[model samples]
Target: MTTQANVDTRISEPDAAQISEFLRDHPDFFDTHQDLLAELRLPHSSGKAVSLIERQVQVLREQNETLKSRLLELVNVARENDRLSGRMHQMTLDLLAASSLVGMLDALEDHLRNEFKADVIALHLPGLSETQLHESGAENLVVNETLKELLPTPLCEGKPQCGRLKQQQLDFLFKDQAAAIESTAVIPIGHHGQGGLLAIGSREVNRFNPCMGTLFLSHLGELLSRMLQKHTAG
Candidate 1:
């Protein structure tokens, strides 16, 4: 009772599910017919059709390039860190060789200016004798009890702070050069904020930020504090 037209209408194309099932069950089919990988084309983002193998090769090449770029970046970072470490060590040695507090401060300022690229370096030490201050040219030494109050509470707690300071605070530290400062890193020296602070200021706004790492600066502060204490004790 089936006519030729009815027979033609009854035939159906394979659905996506059937094709997927067949491919899943015959996983080795592509291995056996490797030419099919080259024959099958996928639409690329560039509106060009690329063979499956070509697409896979392109993806691998891109990943390889990314890895290479990342590796180079790491290498550059390591080299930079090594250079900075060398400079820091050399600065420490110079500080140790310094006989007087002025010599130590001069060394610190010189290294910070030449190596660290700081625009201004100031150490505000409290309780230093007038004679010592004048002899050392330590104009930044406040020697007053209110110096700690000039800094924020967090920094007063003996923490390193980095960011833009208020105009008044900048003036308190840098004086006339305060107008030129855009950013700063304030490293607290001594235990319980007794000794004083080391201020590093820059003309660039982005030179120091709140999120910058303080580990190295903190270690430098401690080292300088011990040196100061020893000098003062003598």
Candidate 2:
């Protein structure tokens, strides 16, 4: 039989050993629990937060795309503007070139050839009043073969040739030669009282139409007239 004291001791002794072991492990276990609790309790972003960030990114992307499209439109407009500006600049140069005396005829000829592409150009000065073609003693006046033939007989008869020749008169004189001369622009090359005529010819029938703007030619004509007046008086 076991003694009572020994039985009690066995039960109490096991209980005391268990208490000591639990005390020894308590600090380490508490530290582990604290780390786990910290992990669980720490701030955790949900799917909603990620979704919000993605939405913001998408909005920014759309804004960037819109900006790029606007930028491209501006670039295209700028290029077109530049092209138009260049054309205008060239036209201005052509106009300026046609406003001088020597340069006027040269520019007019070039413009007609390069711009309007005319075939022939003739400048004519009718005799002044009291100045007979035969008696005026004006030689070395540039005349083509056709004009020489037309003016010779009437001029020998001592007819007065002052005053502007009517358009009808020009039409009558050149009517038969229409087949060879497709188009004609008879521009008066001076102020009303003292100017001569510039006859521009083109092989193309539609080159010198009535509807064409005469502003440039008119200014050039005035310059030519001034030059002629100076030369005649000198």
Which residue pairs collide in model 2, if any?
Answer: 112-117
lDDT of 1 by residue, 22-135 (tens): 989998888999988978999998999999888989999999999999999999988987998899999999999999887888888899999999998777777788888787
Q: What's the TM-score of every candidate structure?
A: 0.76, 0.36
Q: Judging by TM-score against the true structure, name the best candidate.
A: 1
Tell me the RMSD of model 2 versus the true structure: 29.6
Q: Look at candidate 2 and tell me the lDDT of residue 207.
A: 65
lDDT of 2 by residue, 103-177 (tens): 444655565566556566555565443343333222223334564344432233222232223445445434444
Model 2, which residues run further than 4 Å from truth?
1-116, 127-178
In candidate 2, residue 128 scores what lDDT? 40
- Candidate 1 least-lDDT 10 residues: 136-145
User: lDDT score of model 1?
Assistant: 0.83
TM for candidate 1 is: 0.76
Q: Tell me the lDDT of candidate 2.
A: 0.52
